[model samples]
Target: MRSAPFLGLSVAATLSGCAVPEARLRAGLIDAGLPQPIAACMADRMVDRLSLAQLMRIADLPKATASESVPQFLRRVRALGDLEILGVATSSAAACA
Candidate 1:
């Protein structure tokens, strides 16, 4: 019975970790010139679909300049050569836009 309480706490901690990455991703998307709504939506989708390693790879991508468009941002993502990441990013952008 004591283990059950520990399990609950662990579950909470795991779930909390997920939020940090999602919020950071949303901010990154906004910085890349996507509107806030689109950024939020796409971040949610990408966070749910991609693994932590894929997300970290995305986080490592060069920051988007102020003049960059969404398509331009996607081109950089495509260059990563991870088809799953590219697909999630493209589909998320399409759905969010």
Candidate 2:
């Protein structure tokens, strides 16, 4: 997948607060076939504010099943409350954009 490289070193860097550039992260997510709005939302996050597990989940979003739309997947994720703990304001779909 296009995000393979991002999954390895970049995610680690992100968790450490020395994240890869936001543009690169967003492009990687886009290249992985994630919807632009979802990618934008995830890319805008402050990596330092998220836990390693949270970062990993975000990176893995591209692997979501074809049966799921981005909004549906995001809604499920939001329901988990992980994003809330990370301070990601996910009260509306617009927040994701």
Candidate 3:
């Protein structure tokens, strides 16, 4: 019985640690030059679907060039119709425009 409780606590702790804060994600998006509405929508949509690992990858994306804006990067990704991985849809892109 003690082991079961400890296991449950471990799982809860792991899951809590993996959660990406919505505000942080939103701020990251905005800092990357995405308009506020788009940033807000993307953060809200992604927080539920993306793992902490995925969010970290996005946050670490290289901003080496001015042309390589977040919206541009996302547009390229969306062009491949892979928004499901990002937890968004093409319709969400429309809202950003």
Candidate 4:
């Protein structure tokens, strides 16, 4: 229906204002215990691939006090129970490493 298409456009417009910056995403990743280089690589890839809502969601995940290993980070993400987020993070970690 015409209403469905219009609703989609409206939602897109609203989310456009919520776009997460690459630098912020990278910083968040680093805060989450990833190394700087890996965080930067993953942030670039994820910002391109994930939606705004997903990005915002991940931003609120637990941050580590110290740098964490890849396996440790993945395990923490997996614990949160969002498969798509986990998948993107895992693949990005693999690709960036």
Which numbered prediction scores highest in TM-score against the true structure?
A: 1
TM-score to true structure, per model = 0.84, 0.43, 0.51, 0.74
Better of 1 and 4 by lDDT: 1
Which model is ahead, 2 or 3, in terms of TM-score? 3
Q: Model 3 TM-score? A: 0.51
lDDT digits (tens) for residues 41-83 of candidate 4? 9888888777776776666667898889988988987887889
Ranking by lDDT: 1, 4, 3, 2
Cα error of candidate 4 at position 89, Å: 0.8
- lDDT for each candidate structure: 0.86, 0.56, 0.61, 0.82
Residue pairs of candidate 3 with colliding backbone atoms: none
- What 10-residue stretch in candidate 1 is worst by lDDT? 60-69
Name the regions of candidate 2 deviating beyond 4 angstroms.
Answer: 1-17, 21-33, 46-48, 65-68, 78-93
- Stretches of candidate 1 off by over 4 Å are none
Best by lDDT: 1
**lDDT of each residue in 1-97, candidate 1, tens digit only:** 8899999999999999999889888887777667788889989999999998888777667766675666987998899999999999999989988
lDDT of 3 by residue, 1-97 (tens): 7699999999998777545466676676666666678778877777667666555555554443443445585764454444565445344445455
Better of 1 and 2 by TM-score: 1
Candidate 4 clashing pairs, residues 3+ apart or interchain: none
Checking candidate 2 for backbone clashes, the offending pairs are none
24, model 1: CA deviation in Å?
Answer: 2.2
